[model samples]
Target: MSLGAERRHIRDVTAWQPRVPGVVEVFHAHYTEYAYPMHVHDAWTLLVVDDGAVRYDLDRHEHGTPHGTVTLLPPHVPHNGEPVTEAGFRKRVLYLEPGALDTSLIGAAVDEPDLRDPLLRRRVGQLHTALAHPGDELEAESRLVLVRERLRHHLRPRPVRQPHPDERPLARRLRELLDERTAQGVTLGEAAALVHAHPAHLVRAFSTAFGIAPHQYLMSRRVEHARRLLLAGQPPGEVAALSGFYDQAHLTRHFKRWVGVPPGRYARTSASLT
Candidate 1:
């Protein structure tokens, strides 16, 4: 098929992924001839250009992203985008909710939308890749930290962190509760009540101590539970329901997303390898 025909077979992935807190949407697209209308997003729009280039007008100023460039479009900024090359462009875009980046860090990006740091660019790309797979929660979070640190280093230095009181005990307790109620699932409020803290406070504390959100930690654990059950020869349907997922399809969705393959494929592969 011609490149144009091949492009036709592909569809733009404008998925509203809530994989992480403070993130609203994740977009991945390859376009040969596409243009966006002048619009604004309520969340920060971060773009990672993989191949080719994109031209856009951000806040009334024109900008061009060359191949391998990464750009940050702050929230509420009006912008429109179109391809700058014949091959068009392939990009991963993130729509992050407010508070993902501190107010202080945003100004630098406003003055310079396209960043030149290779490390920052690389981590952004890695973040996207990790988010697409299963069991990559830690990697994704780690990349987020590095990306933030890199941005801070370039824009303005943050005060060095000192030793702080440990909150691991609370984090551990929350994890235990989640494990005990895996199938039934504990609401954040229930977890907070069990821990004798406000739900919002509990979320912040748990994430601070563990480096991953409570919901994410529970999700990873459930996926782990399903893996064990699957390895023991349980069918996907049972694994799904038993592992806190509503049904087989629900389980398959999170399973493949976190584990890199569907449960059946994972089981069959493991059997062959063994």
Candidate 2:
């Protein structure tokens, strides 16, 4: 088999680790002829092909990326990818932490790695978009929660369990924790552990009690903190660090969404008033 042409045309490949919880890595690739060798990953592989298609073998069974589908390759499973056409393929992948999905579901994933669900495909696409932008961690995290839920739904269908009796207390505790760590913030997993609840349940409790998602609530609080810092004349970049944002862009995005102007302009205008 000729590998030279394929090797030379392997052009686009990008990978990074975002700060969002439950995600280990994000990768995007475009290739016309490149093929992936049989390999195993320690994390769960959630993949979607944006253009073209991919043919792969998981656990000795052949699989392909059909149009409007999401593929979930379980951890420790061996897989390989090949181009399905002369046009090659473009794909975005999320490597989820092992804990993101239960290990027992590995069997189900290996049995049916390719899922034909339009909602899952769309949600995965939205997740990739969120991951690509630096200031969109909150959005990314929120989308990830939904994506995980959808994946779990496919791998193992379960009945909806009723909320526990202490749901209100759990929400109140989460709110208090958020108040105490507004500047620092907290991951849903960490908050759940501290509050003695499951991560999904914790999100439900908080949102039900406050009518806002945890990430949205946190971003709003950070924006409020940034406002105070801007009024005190702190630079936007510096205020971002003090306000618990990933960077100035992150701070500015939320600040403008919550406030009416950018941090610099807001600071200047407030100074004029004083």
Candidate 3:
């Protein structure tokens, strides 16, 4: 199936049951007029907004999410959400148990250490696939292996960084743009324009100063906003759009690839905890 069709199938199946024990349930829901209040979950809650904008409060911080965004909530973090307008909202939720990851695999060993890192999109994809198709021990083992390899690769040490006082002006401008437009999605060229430099020059400077490219930094900011919305109870489709993704499917593709589960499943599992 195409990625879009596959995601729809996954979303449909996820809404059926709570899925595996200790593995948590994945599901989707729409809030026409109702909304979820502040609540906490015993399991990790990951999600994406699929439709309208959802407003959320996480640890006293508030966020407004549109569509095509992914959200991640660590276990037990107090959060709540509601629709921003009368249109209501739609979203996906996934619940994940502590230690549910297969530590026997090398990638699984490092999963926890970097769970909060925004760059783990691929790891999330593997976990989602494993949960989507639960079966024999051998298949599970293979999934674990894939997770291990990915984690191992991620955990490898990289060269240390040195502070650059010279890049402060550019860096500050980049950060401001990220903070203001994270939901809108900022491109490298656009970011560079603010600093009166070429995209390539800005990218090189950003890498040397922050150890990552400009676009990666922007994605991290977007993901952070998405997380805040999920905790507040925004739907996946809305979150995706707000986070600069093209659509629900686009957001799901990246969210599952990064966070290990679809957005709707994350929200449903989170709601169930309350």
Candidate 4:
């Protein structure tokens, strides 16, 4: 319901713990004049303002996440949410576990927090509704996957890197470097310096030699490592560190992109299949 320009009589806060394995907390709140003071969370704060409009600030930058925008705040990032209109706003929030998502997805949100995608908004509702039910975990997880995928689409940049057929040698050296230092992220310049090539040239050459960018190949290796860890029953947080991902959320983003699903879900499905 659109709270619109008129203040409604709704003033309530309903919060609970989702019975789902990875979710931390779920909350629904309606406000008219409430302005939250700047705060920080230890988990990824996912919010969907259903009606009217809500505004928030992350790392000193303000954002408006109304009906269509999804508010994504990475862990430890300070933020505040308040109503935008006199009628205030209504919001559904999910405070995900620190290890709930891949650290890279959260990084994407950190770079572009206000995800203004219509499909993502709908998927959020679907995921939330599924989460509201306690026993339909399969459905909830299914919806969560789609929601995350859509969010990732908005958060990640897809640049086409064309390869130079003759530069495979340089690209090969960069690939070796990436394999050697999977945990420590290598910059384009670093890869270039290692092979005595310009950054752009090295990128093209790497793509030519491996059919994927230097970063992509490295990430694929990391994803494979994370997958093994998951299959071994290691948690996402530990898997993230072990797989050379910066964090669980970062691992999630890359894992989903490479493996077609999040690590937790992959592990569960693999276990069931096994």
Q: Rank the candidates by lDDT, best first.
A: 2, 4, 1, 3
How many backbone collisions does model 2 have? 0
Q: With candidate 4 superimposed using the best TM-score fit, by how many Å does residue 230's alpha carbon deviate from the native?
A: 31
- Where model 3 places Cα greater than 4 Å from the true spot, the runs are 1-162
TM-scores, each model vs. reference: 0.53, 0.55, 0.42, 0.53
* Root-mean-square deviation of Cα positions for candidate 3 versus the true structure, in angstroms: 15.9
Q: Is candidate 1 or candidate 3 better by TM-score?
A: 1
For 1-274, candidate 4 gives per-residue lDDT tens digits of: 5655344544555545555666666657677766764444557778888889978776556778756788788764555667788788878887777777676565567567887778888888998898777788899878877876776667664332323547756766886788688777788877777789889877777655444456656776676566556766688999999888888899998765543356777666435423
**Candidate 2 at residue 242, lDDT?**
95
For model 2, residues 11-38, the per-residue Cα lDDT tens digits are 5655556678998777666777667655
Model 2 lDDT, full chain set: 0.76
Ranking by TM-score: 2, 1, 4, 3
Pairs of residues at least 3 apart in sequence or in different chains that clash in candidate 1: 134-257, 134-258
lDDT of 3 by residue, 134-241 (tens): 363355446545543544454444332333878756765775677688677677777778778888877777655554455655655455456546645789888888
Q: lDDT for each of the candidates?
A: 0.69, 0.76, 0.56, 0.70
- lDDT assessment of candidate 3: 0.56
